[model samples]
Target: MMRIFLMATLGTLTAFAPPAHAQQAGETRLVVRPSPAVPATPTPDQQAAVLERFARARDNLVALREGRRSVSDLSPQELQDVLDYDRRVRGDYPDTRGAKQQCIDDEFRRAGGRPSALARQVIALKCRN
Candidate 1:
């Protein structure tokens, strides 16, 4: 048990330590570099498609909140598309953060504190973007 404990401790230390070569070179820190390749701009058609998906997802969320639809009625692809688009846009447009957060808050309230799985799904689709 003592040997095992020592081995585990040594392994943990080894896993976290910087590369041996870096240590030898007198470097104690790691440098992180951002990606060099910029993401490709979306074409007009692609942008339109994303907007359409967002609209559909929002409509579905509203229907769900109103009890006019069920979770099964929600489109996973539509939710994912809007979320992915939002992820990209939020990074580029910091000004949108406030609007997006407000949307999320409204949706959460509309979900009635997520009393049901369907309510949770509605909030995710409506405001997770």
Candidate 2:
């Protein structure tokens, strides 16, 4: 009777043991949980920095649009520089993403230039293409 009881207890314990796949060759296990708070908003200084970065990105885009500069003409490093500036601006000033493009389109329209087609192309190129 005692042997049977010991066998049952051992069987239950083995069943509750961690799975083989859960064990790494040389790592300890840890449990992680997501926090329940919203991320903090950027400060005023960060907002200004974001605006400046966006302006720099816009200037690069303008140069690329004009014959004064070419995307292909830029070196790999220069291309990366532009992309990094764009990412920084987007990270901090997400609301301005479409707004800035709209502003540019409005300017062109004010100048009596039909810019929807070009604006679409620019948006495609800058954000996706």
Kindly list the per-residue Cα lDDT of model 2 for residues 1-129, writing each as its tens digit: 999999999999989998788776887769798888897899999999878866766788668767778889777866766787766756854455465667666666664776578775675455441
lDDT of 2: 0.73
Please give the lDDT score at residue 48 for candidate 1.
100
lDDT of each: 0.72, 0.73
Clashes of each: 0, 0
lDDT of 1: 0.72
> How does candidate 2 fare on TM-score?
0.31
Residue 95: error of model 1 in Å? 20
> Which has the greatest TM-score?
1
Clashes of 1: 0
Best by lDDT: 2
> In candidate 1, residue 115 scores what lDDT?
44
Name the runs in model 1 displaced over 4 angstroms: 1-37, 79-129
